[model samples]
Target: MRFSWLLLLPLLAACNSNPSAERGEPGFGAADPESPADATALPAPDTASTKAVSAVSDTLRTVRQKHNFSNPKGPADLFKLVYRGPSILDGTGEFTITNPTGEVIFREMLTEPDLEAALVYEMKNPTATRAERETYVLRRIDRFFVPSQFHTPAIDPNAAFPTGLETLERATWDDLQHRPDAIGFDYLKGKEDRQRIAWSPLTKQVVRVQ
Candidate 1:
């Protein structure tokens, strides 16, 4: 009787495992073992670099907007904008001004051979006829902020020159040479006051301001 009971135990367990026949309902967890299906799998993708770039971009925008200036470039990109001077000792380049992203936002290369001529032409062709040429000329002259003494002999401030007129560029030399009120050329010998108090277009008066 014990051996017969042991043989019947296997049959009882198998019937219990079948929910549809043993219980009143079908088993939810049961699946056909022989069912055919496609296996779902994919190659693991590398996202490290993509994530890094996104993080850097976010940080860059936040930093640039803090200053009034827009989209300033990173140090590497800034260095790439080689001045290739005659640029003022101040690092003002003759060619291009770029943002942090390597985009050229401003360019001074209006013409070849003569940068001053290009500046004069731009001044002469004022956006508004009512605007004075002197204002534009002064503004453009300020762009040539190189700290080293004038490279060309024609513009040497040291050479005997008139007062009030400062440096003797060929242009200024021609205008002030015959004038009696001319102060002294040596006045221009000092560091150029790029921010010198001059007439203000916005105020329309000689304001003692930048």
Candidate 2:
């Protein structure tokens, strides 16, 4: 899938606005007893401050290659690597996979388990392209994936949020807007859309859209 350069506008805006967005979290691994259980229970050491995290990521890939996980076959198999922007302290992120026609298959915030699974899948499948690998890697380091257990379900009488990772799955595009620094991705070909989206903490409405 080819993408126009215009797709990058939102990402560029995010990058320029926060130069340190990619740095992960400061003192991410430092012990903090006062931190919430959600904060301390992270799957892996924060990637921003250490090369070891990258090394571990690579090893996981190698193992997955040895096992031969399959490449995504359709929209259902497709996964979107989402990053919440710089405004949030933890740089929350998500993994969303949609079907070929653009229906969401699954959405999970990046957690240690989710990242490990994604990395292994990318490594095992020879058909998985560079773009896919890069997207996975970027999400791995960006600190976007938060454990789903942290969020309380917004009040709605009709639907019940799925438990575990499924809890991270969002029910609508409107939900995506609520996320800080929300960015969308096409994992297979490495294309990204929804470049113009910003959330207003004050008004709680999508403040910007492109």
Candidate 3:
């Protein structure tokens, strides 16, 4: 599933739809619930501040390898590593990366929230031959994997895991753009063709592509 960069001018330049564009379907940027027990719980944190976002990312990175994708400990336990205290809802999430030697490499804060219970992520090894930055996202829907009642297999509706590499790459870029806290990240997943592009905040050029 090779993606051609020459194509995809439409999606790259498409206009972002309003929150109501989906006819009341909650937009990714909508406000998150105030409590984790809220019915319409969102994955965001309590405060979308820079410090809070960084804390969230750092936590995720610390637990990325320690966590058992096959079995989770608990939401409170998971959040504790990242929040340094109680976790709060704020409509923003973080992405973190770790090297094979268990050293922190890179981290980014996004609009994804409260995924400790249902999401799993792993950064592609930076030393790979192609040197492409890729991350894996998943959602856990199946319970019983963890001792706590909150156990479930993290599922990624937008993720294309079993599919080829192209879908997987597109999902990653899409996730970044969908973030409500993305003030510096630039993402581009071309439309009508298998193309993906991501840019940094400063240079405004393609940093990753597929």
Candidate 4:
């Protein structure tokens, strides 16, 4: 009688093939919720603002910034980061980034408070009309994907990471700082809170640069 181990091959293979065995790795946390719950359309922030528009799952606006934000050698406007749904402040919104072939690589809820920075200009003039304030957000969104808003070196040595990023985040920030061709998205979150987001070749996903 001979003892053989070949009988265990199929059992071992079956365990390896089980889908449940797969698990997601840990990633750095973000300040904002990556996915925002859909909220009912609220009255415009200002009483003098335009009448609230009814909420519907419709395309509000789409902006394709003419820049190679997704890839280093890619042509201009290779990626279209669309601003969908109604204006961030008026209704629940979403920001989705699509590749050249129209495949969405990144998707995130666009919260209203993020665009509140646009209201600062109107605050300057106590009598600023509602239309003028609305225009400010429109212009801010239009320029959201402009070339000027995309920085080559995502991370700045002098820039402060007020959020106190973790080890994984610091690694990603350092990684972007070294890549000269890597482009990052720069936008205002609060009054003057500038946020930097970029597609990390290493992470194979979009990450907030410190």
Candidate 5:
């Protein structure tokens, strides 16, 4: 875990930090699951999803999916995702990571806008339909936490790091140069919003690199 801090530091510079849309913070700015703009063009569900629903009344869209990062130091399936809404096109996503024993160490929220903003590449045509957009977002969630998504020593040691790190982040960044095995969770909120999270054994918790 000590190495994890080192790994995530470099990611701070690489990812976007929206003052109003941070993951751990409340709202995630996802006011309405189905935006009026999107719903106007989208049709009603032909059938409800078979996935088990939580206590909430809103549609439990993307069923909680457990992802095993399988670190080199050996923790299997550390991350889990629980989402609610009709679908990601208009959903709220809960991102959490736990230790081997299933104790949650980190948690955050992402709304449709937060996740959808990054899909501009897929929806290049401003007029793409709701169905087409949903297909793309769903695929993003499916492949979110695979091994290929995690980075070993998330920051390339040889690459120049960002210059604005705070005291603790700077220390972690400096230490990461030697920890080739340090693993960092990596994903994107949108095209410019790449997120990389790492664990810190010293802090006994996970810290957002930025």
Candidate 6:
């Protein structure tokens, strides 16, 4: 199904406007009430995961220098940078400048060409699962310029595995799903509704469920 990217603006506005309203809810900023006490326990990264993370960090550093994309010195200096060719990734791209504190000051949907290319590349990889492909694309872009640890959601034992690319593509709503001010948006389909949903990433509580 085709998604209307235009709907993203209002969704973002809603989250940015009231991120603290649901801070106490499960998966918002509080621990999931239904999860086991050890659910948040994570083991040390394996050799492969460690190597992959290091590779991405190195690539991002090179891309930042090659493009002259210096980190923002302050919040007032943050803004979008657009790319028209294959310098950083295999295609065109755009990303926000990260603040000196390393927080992303802007948010946008995944419309960048580099992300699109990554998706295409992942689709062609015979050994990659759908989740792996989507994760690859998101990490490669790092649109939010967030810390690697907050790039994705924690394992939610109650949440079903995402079905495919479309579902994964809309999974940003759950990004940083355990921080008090975490905010993001995504496309979701409920029993009687199908539209983009904006929510507090810290709690996963809906601010605008439509």
Which window of ten consecutive residues has the lowest lDDT sum in model 1? Answer: 60-69
lDDT at 114, model 3? 35
Q: List clashing residue pairs in candidate 6.
A: 27-203, 28-202, 28-203, 29-202
TM-score leader: 5
Overall lDDT per candidate, in order of appearance: 0.32, 0.38, 0.32, 0.62, 0.65, 0.39
- For residue 44, what is the lDDT in candidate 6? 54
For model 4, give the RMSD to the true fold.
20.8
Model 3: lDDT of residue 83: 24
Between candidates 3 and 6, the one scoring higher on TM-score is: 3
65-179: candidate 2 lDDT, tens digit per residue: 0100011222122434544433222233455544445554444454333343446544766555656655665555443323321122222234344343331334443464444
Off by over 4 Å in 1: 19-99, 102-210
* lDDT (10s digit) by residue, model 5, range 128-208: 787877776666666667667777775677856566544346666656546677667887885687766666654556654
Q: Identify the runs in model 6 with alpha carbons over 4 angstroms from their true place.
A: 1-79, 86-91, 100-176, 185-210
TM-scores of all candidate predictions against the true structure: 0.17, 0.21, 0.20, 0.58, 0.62, 0.19
Report the C-alpha lDDT of model 3 over 1-210, residue by residue, as the tens digit.
236654665576565556453454456654444645655555565675555335544443222223322112221112111223222322333434332344443444433233332222232443422112112111221121223422122222354443444333544455544543322212211122222323323332233323
Which candidate, 2 or 3, has the higher TM-score? 2
Cα lDDT of model 4 by residue, 170-190, tens digit: 666666777877878777765
Name every residue pair that clashes in candidate 5: 68-77, 118-190, 118-191
- Candidate number with the higher TM-score (3 or 5): 5
Please estimate how well model 6 matches the true structure, expressed as its whole-model Cα lDDT. Answer: 0.39
Per-residue error (Å), model 3, residue 133: 30
Least lDDT summed over 10 consecutive residues: which range in candidate 5? 61-70
Provide the clashing-pair count of each candidate structure.
9, 10, 21, 0, 3, 4
